[model samples]
Target chain A: MKSVMIVGVGGQGTLLASRVLGRVMLDAGYDVKVSEVHGMSQRGGSVVTYVRWGDKVESPVINEGEADVLLAFEQLEAARFLPYLKKDGVVVTNTQQIDPMPVITGAAVYPEKLIEKLEEKGVRLTALDALSLAKEAGSQKAVNVVLIGAMASSLDIPEALWIEAIEKTVPPKFLEMNKRAFELGFHA
Target chain B: MKELLQGNEAVARGLYEAGVTVVSSYPGTPSTEITEAAAMYDEIYCEWAPNEKVAAEVAAGAAIGGARSFCGMKHVGLNVAADPVFTMSYIGVNGGMVIGVADDPGMHSSQNEQDSRNYAIAAKLLMLEPSDSAECRDMTKLAFELSEQFDTPVMLRLSTRIAHSRSIVDTVDRVDVPLRPYVKNAAKNVMLPAFARPKHEMVEARTVKEREWAEICALNFVEDNGSATGVIVAGSVYKYAKEALGDTVNYLKLGVVNPLPVEKIRNFANGLDKVYVIEELDDILETHCRKIGVEVIGKDLFPRCGEFSQKLIAEKMGVARDESVSIEESIPVRPPVMCCGCPHRGLFYALKREGVYVSGDIGCYTLGASAPLGAMDACICMGASISALHGYNKARGAEAEKKAVAVIGDSTFMHSGVTSLIDIAYNRSNSTVIILDNSITGMTGHQQNPTTGLTIKGDPTSAVDLEALCRAIGIQDVQVVDPYDLKATRAALKAALTAECPSVIISRRPCALLKTVKHKPALTVDTDKCIGCKACMGIGCPAISMKDGKAVIDATQCVGCGVCTDLCPKKAIG
Candidate 1:
């Protein structure tokens, strides 16, 4: 089983990542089940989407120390969800930070040196300047895709599967850029 | 093949697959999308009622007329519909009607984190909570089936996480589960005391029978682990239990939460060395276990409030709380606030300055009750401000009437404020009501509402004219003020509050955060002529701040509506 958890703030396209992963797994001939934490997602709150795929999948939630990949769209949120990964799991994350409600309200502070801490724990980590990369891709909002692209190497799923998933998930007008974004994620 | 869909869309698909013919709901987060999704299907007759109660009644009426029906709202919506819901429990149903009330455990878009589970118990209806999109769909389909089977309404409970999240739902072919033909029975449908007394007896009997039925039903299942320790949990939290306990603990995962399968639970707990009842927010399950002579760890072990994660579950279960998982320390918190170019900012600033007792309602305007603007004195629930304002005036008389103003949102006013406005007009409380028409349900991710002339699925719908509605309610003093036009908004607010009769001021502006609305160029301060009076800071625009003895605006962040232009008394800034 290859389990992936994507963590990001609300409106960060975390859902799209899961869909793309699910499609990729299905294309690879594996059974895939994707789940998500919804509701307050659009409120700029901490949001996570889970995708579990294998020859056959039973549950959507990845058990503790069982996630094969952790794709994080924000630094603090990645730190917040770091526990989902296995001891030897790889983490691909955006170096950019979008503070959650608690941070802006003075109730908490954004954890600095998060990637350093993750690296120290012997977790295979790749940090990309996702916001800048998304800007380079002509949409700063595509940061989620930038982080998703960084995780493409491990997927081993066909490019077509990713395309189909992106096509199904995004609205029709946004399809082309999202395909390019998927390619970016796949190539990253 | 599973298709990608939004949480709301899947629930709609679930209803469609289940063959629901009638759908009615008032817009709300986590729940709004369900009806919106259902509306897209021509087979389903969907409408947005003025309030939860009306929506519930309409669904109940459809069920009475022999159609499987559904109504959805946020948790607070249940309170508004409780009267009908409780009565419907006694009356039962003809066609199955599933009522969805999504609870925001962390108060994500609500004023309070009240669990809808308690309402299920209070109303004596079957309640099922879906843990994810699949269950959100599956349980919704099942809810309709169970509702008809039990001759009762079923509550399809959802949380913020389940309602808004996307998941892959493998749906079955659409089932044409229509209601049997309706035949009105005066003895049953009409609840005179004599008729109601027998119906009440039937209600109690039905609950007992439902519990017995739940024990054998597929909804409540015992997942045996060959372990002595057993855990009973339901809804989304059930996923947490499954994740944290692994192969060590057995579980009695109940899908139908109401009329809980006590015998089956006791049977499952009989041989266990320890029992734990895990749930989010409340101890309804824990209380049931304790009442039925089963000892279990719940609220006392885990915190009573907020959502839970797998790590929290492991810690409470006395196991390693993810020893391999490392969290970054010293992370800063960022509380949600109104967006930088928010239209409500200046209006709230004026309210705060005037020191008025503002009874706030739900929406982005709720952010005004937070720090800086801190204008609103109270926020009880949706559409509460108008009624609360009336009560305040009645209690405190002239002084209260002079200082207090009821602040509500355009969408919220359309949702439930209309009735309260009617009340104010009928009684002539002389209370000032301000409808902050940001042209969207801003709190719940800017879903369109009646005033926005848009449907939840982005289709064009009839726009409810607030001024016309006020006029219809017989309020002569109705004015529209652009909230971004601070002088006009302030003047209108002042004038309305001073009027001898009940009046309404519509603070008209599209929400700044709305993607459809383009923002003006970011305002810049001429540093050469800048004198830092910090007057612009009074409005609490996040983009404008005092830096190095001069008023500075972050160009990258600001959506320049020129709001701060008037704030600088010295005329040195902007």
Candidate 2:
């Protein structure tokens, strides 16, 4: 059984990324269960999605301490979801920072040195400027695909399967750019 | 073929497979996608009714006319439609009718974490609950059959996790089931005193037979792993228990929640060393176990609060979860906020400046209650703003009228706010109602409403004219303002607030997320001349942030509505 947790702020394209991952696992003949957060939470709030696959999966929830991999799309969200990661779990995080409401309202501060702090904890962290890589591929919206490409480096799935999954999951109009984004992040 | 489908989507597939002819629903979180998915199929007729009550009545009328009909709504939506639902329980159906209600146990997008299963019992309706997408599909199809076999309407209960989660489901072709002939039987349909009295007896008799059938149904079967710890669970909680304890604990898994099998649960609890009734939000099942003289460890061990998870279940049972690590640091919470360049911002900013008590309704504009642009006061449910504002004024007399105003979205105004507004006029209160017309249903992913000038399928339709409707409702004072135009909006709000008679201020602007709406280029800050007084942050736009004592705006997030530009004291924002 394998569990992957995708954490990001709302409207950051995490839902589409989970769909691509779900497609990949389903095509691999594994029973896949993916949980999503929708409605009110999608309005610039912290959002988490769970993707699990096995011979037969029971629960769609990936609770605290159960996630094998944490794919984070922002610095603060990455640090916030660290508790969900297993002891030896690997983290693929994008270095982009989006201020939450409290920080904007001067009620709190955005924590600094998140990547350095996580690395100092003896955690295996793969950090990248996914937003920049996505920009190189033509749009910053492809940041999700770029992170997926980076996360693929630690995953055992074939490169061909990842591409196939992207093909099936992404819309035709933006397919070429997302593929470019994936390639750039995969090699970075 | 097996495909991963969300539980709500699977319910639509089941509706299609069951040959449902009419499906009506009002857009609510978790339950909205069911009708949206059903609309994808060409055979079924789907619609976005004005409100849950109208939706239920539509479904009930279709069923009475001999068509398999279904209505879907969030738990609170059931409260709106319960008037018709309770009577439909006795009136029965000519064909088959099913109601799909999804509860928000953790109040994810809902005002309350109400247990919808209670509605099933109170309404005397048979209820089926599914844990995953596959069961969502199967139970929906079975619900229709069970409804027809018992001559009653069936309710399918789902929680947030079950409604929103994706799980693999085996696909099957739609079955061809012709509708039953519509027979004229007023004795059963009409709810007159004499006729309804007989139907009430039939309902009691029906419950008895359904309870008997519940005892041996395959859906209530037990999985005895011969373990001493027995857990009686249902819906998503059952799946979480399985994931946490696996086969270490014996399980009495139930799919039929209402008209619960007492004898089956008693037998399952008899041999176990410990019995735990684990349910989310409420002790509906636990209370049932005790009524039948069964000793079960429930609510005492499991707090009747938020959603239960695998880790919580494991910890409660003295089982250990996998080890995890995190750096010790406090993180700021990220609550949902209004999108950048939201139309509601201008009106809310104006209301905040005026310091008026803004009675609010359910919608994206409810985020007006959030900090910075905090404007709204009360938000109970759909259309509660108008009526509540009227009552507030009537309670305090005319002084409260100018101090308070009701604000509702265009979609919500059409949903139930129209009647709420009518109450203010008919009762002759000096209340001012502001209709935030974003031109679409902004909350539940932009489903078209009666005010949207489009159908659920995006077909052209007649849109409601707010100004004309207000005139017809005997309100002579109707002011329209562009929410993007701060000056105009504030002026209009002032006029309505001071009006001698009841009046309305319509703040009109399309939602920023709508594709048809064009945005100006992202604004830049003239940091060289900026004082960073933080005046622009008053609107709470996510795009603007501070760096090195200067305001900076991210191009990716800024829609350049220039609401912030209007706020900069030094004119630093462009």
What value does DockQ give for candidate 2?
0.87
Deviating ranges (above 4 Å) for candidate 2: none
Which pairs of residues clash in candidate 2, taking residues 3 or more apart in a chain or in different chains? none
B25, model 2: CA deviation in Å? 0.2
TM-score of each: 0.88, 0.99
Q: Assess each model's interface with DockQ, reporting 2 decimals per model.
A: 0.35, 0.87
Query: For model 2 chain A, where is the 10-residue window of minimal lDDT?
Result: A59-68
lDDT of 1 by residue, B194-260 (tens): 9999998888998988888888988788889899898888876777777677879999988888988
Best by DockQ: 2
RMSD of 2: 1.0
What is the per-residue lDDT of model 2 for residues B1-574, given as tens digits with 9 covering 90 to 100?
7989999999999999999999999999979999999999988999999999999999999999999999999999999999999999999998799999999988889898889988989999999999999999999999999999999999999999999999999989998779889889999999998999999999999999999889999889799898998999999999999988999989999999999998999999987889999999889999999999999999999978888888899999899777878878889999999999899998999999999998999999999999988898889999999999998898888888888899999989999999988888898889999999999998899999988889988899999888999989888899989887888988998888888999999999999999999999999999887898999888889998888888999998999999988888888888
Cα lDDT computed for each candidate against the true fold: 0.79, 0.92
TM-score of candidate 1 versus the correct structure, residues matched by position: 0.88
